[model samples]
Target: MTTESIDTAAEIEAIHAVVAAVQKAQRAEDADAFLALFHPDAIWTTGGGKFLNGRDEISEFTRAVLPGATKDGYATYEPFFVRFIRPDVAAVKVRQQYFNHADELQSQGSPLYGMTKEDGRWLLTFCQNTPVVDH
Candidate 1:
């Protein structure tokens, strides 16, 4: 493979790692771990339409919700597509699914995560979680 291909592959892997970290953190209810994957100025919008600006606001919101989020079911975040807007920036499309202990689907969401590479690490800069509603 060419050097460019190699670099692209590595970058994709790194991005996937960040996505996996999100799932891991949420599943484990590790707020610190979840927050660490975001940039200090990150913004997050919930599926319910609440907007959280910056890491502090995101932290507060996550702390309040995440702890109990998995009490009934655990969520899995799977990145199905990633588009690179720049070498250091990517738009990731993730499928979020929550399953109960019985392995039944409880809820589903589509989240768009805008990730940026800062200090050689991929961090989520912006994220919007939208619930999959059936009409």
Candidate 2:
């Protein structure tokens, strides 16, 4: 493989790891772990349409909701696509599914996460969680 291909592979792997951390944090209800994956100036918009600006706001929102968000059901985030805009920036499309304790499907979400590589670490810089609605 060429150097470019190798670099791309490594970058994709790093981004995937970041996405996996999100799933792990959410599933385990580890607010601190979840928040640590984001940049200090990150922005997040919930599936319900609430806009959270910056890490402070994200931290507050996540800490308040995440712990109980999965009490009845657990959430899983799977990245289906990753587009690199620059060597240090990437846009990742994720499919999020919620399952009840019995493993029944609860809801689905399509979230787009913008991540940036800083100090060799990939951190989420922006995210928009959109609910999948069926008419």
Candidate 3:
């Protein structure tokens, strides 16, 4: 998409909103809210390296794991980089962090979300969460 055809600033803002929503859902351990952010055929790879295809698969995995995930603390996502391949497609790089109840960082994740605009709403179409380990 050309610059004249789309507003880059608005798109970026919308993308950030999605990321913020994900963070909120995670903090609340709201699996349904989190799943609603993905496309029907979305793909996801967890930080532990489990590959899930489609919303059904994601839902299954999420339901199994999301509960009590935030009993101690929660994961947070920040969309620091966004590359628009087109007006409707973007690659977002997020900084994911897991903190303990005392706010100490326990683990970090580098998650890349492949987002697509479907019906004017941006949805996570493909994503991979890789744990960050200190060398």
For candidate 2, lDDT tens digit of each residue in 1-135?
123433888888889899899999998889999999999999999988999999999999998888676779888888999888777888899999989999999889999999999999999998999999988
Model 3 sits at a Cα RMSD from the real structure of 1.1
TM-score of each: 0.93, 0.93, 0.96
Would you give me the overall lDDT of model 1? 0.91
Candidate 1 wrongly placed segments (more than 4 Å): 1-6
Across 1-135, the per-residue lDDT of candidate 3 in tens digits comes to 554588989999999999999999888889999999999999999988999999999999999999988888878899999999888999999999999989999989999999999999999999999989999
Model 1, 3-96: lDDT tens digits are: 3433877898999999999999999999999999999999999999999999999999999988877778898989999888888888999999
Best by TM-score: 3
Write down the worst ten-residue block by lDDT for model 1. Answer: 1-10
Q: lDDT order of candidates, best first? A: 3, 1, 2
Each prediction's RMSD to truth: 2.7, 2.6, 1.1
Error of 3 at 92 (Å): 0.1
Whole-model Cα lDDT per candidate?
A: 0.91, 0.90, 0.94
**Candidates arranged by TM-score, highest first:** 3, 1, 2
Judge candidate 3 at residue 109 and give its lDDT: 92
Q: Provide the lowest-lDDT 10-residue window in model 2.
A: 1-10
